[model samples]
Target: MTADDHALALALADAAGAAIRPFFRGAWSEERKADRSFVTEADRAAEAAMRALIEAHRPADGIIGEEYGTRNEGAGRQWVLDPIDGTTSFIAGRAIFGTLIALVQDGWPVLGVIDQPIAQERWVGRIGEGTTFNGRPAATRPLKDLSDAVLGTTTPHQFAGDDVDAFMGVARAVAESKIIYGGDCYNYGLVASGHIDCVIEAGLKLHDFAALVPVVEGAGGMMSDWMGNPLDAGSDGRVIALGDPARLDDILDAMS
Candidate 1:
């Protein structure tokens, strides 16, 4: 990615944050999506703002947004967005929900930004470069063993069938009372900042996770599918983000 691309990614996050701040903890329209997930006026507005800026700055690039469908299909570069990743947290007046933005090129994510407007915390990541949290360098904390690691995920309800069993296996391996719920995209940011060791989840869409890979990997961590494959557009929704890569095999063993 070029310097201008990075600038544009930050600008997109800024626009999305501005559009979402007015609705946080305030009155706004809300409804359930076909998937039974919640959607709000703020989500739509934030994505619209980002799309407008993308169109103005790089009309050739494509877009895949949660609120709005895809545009400029088949383009080599695409912007994937989730205006508010944790709608439940947002509806509950929490600041942990975040706006996720990603730039995917040739089916691989090259840049990502996770913006929590309410908290005014932002994490930016680019391939081949270090990650930054609010302009400061960000890095994950090292852990020597799974028993000492802290784990996080948005909710156990997101898992079902075998996915639930797999998640429980990982939870059981971690220290007692070390698992946290209800951070959504914010949890990955915490992983990047060394405040959380890992996050595991399933049924995530491209918009839900496209931005997380770069941020976590750039901060000396690793993100992959449940079976330890690199995440790309074609991978299944199962995800694992680890602050300490050495623990991957242990986590995978636990999952199995």
Candidate 2:
């Protein structure tokens, strides 16, 4: 993809962002998913509009979305999207939610877009082309020793006894960490662009993560699970990411 294609995606994200903003000020109807999570009308609208744009631009491209599920089954090129990652927060009028889009070629991510419309921020990354924030080059912050870094995770109440024990087990070892709830997927985008240092959390899916890997890597970060592997173990969504590979072992040790 050239600068022009990136520009087009930016425009698409901007439009989708605009569509989500009105729901921001006023209340929108919502429904509960089977998982008991809230899904607002904005999610449906944003993904629909995003899907139309991708179809018109890349007719042959595959699409996997949170609200609408998967379409255009092929192995060559694919687009992953989460129109409104934090619908619960968006419905509650929180600013942490955002839109995510990723284009994957062959088996790897080639381009990613994370547009937080409310915050007026666009984080973009194209493999080999480097990563940028609103057209400016972006990089992760200088990695600090594990003993002096900040880690962000979501709600802890969702964990059970053993889960809570395991989570706190890691927390106790961290030099300093905070469980910042309600970020939805925006935290990953923030980490990709170096706004956050590391994030370890549970409960995620491919759509929750696919758009994040390349952007974070493009910004010089590494993400994995408790086993020091990608979250492809086919179990739960326990995942971890760090801005420094040097501290990966430490993070893993704490998780263990």
Best by TM-score: 1
Clashing pairs in 1: none
> lDDT, candidate 1, residue 34?
98
Q: For candidate 2, report its TM-score.
A: 0.89
Alpha-carbon RMSD to native, per candidate: 0.7, 2.4
Clashes of each: 0, 0
Please write out the lDDT profile of model 2 over residues 216-241, one tens digit for every residue: 77788877766787543143567777
lDDT tens digits, residue span 157-254, model 1: 88999988899999999887898988999999999999999899999999999999999999999999999999998879999999999999999999
- The stretch of ten residues in a row with the least summed lDDT in candidate 2 is 230-239
Model 1: which ten-residue window has the lowest total lDDT?
Answer: 173-182
lDDT of 2 at 37: 86
Candidates in order, TM-scores: namely 0.99, 0.89
**Each prediction's Cα lDDT score?**
0.94, 0.75
Off by over 4 Å in 1: none
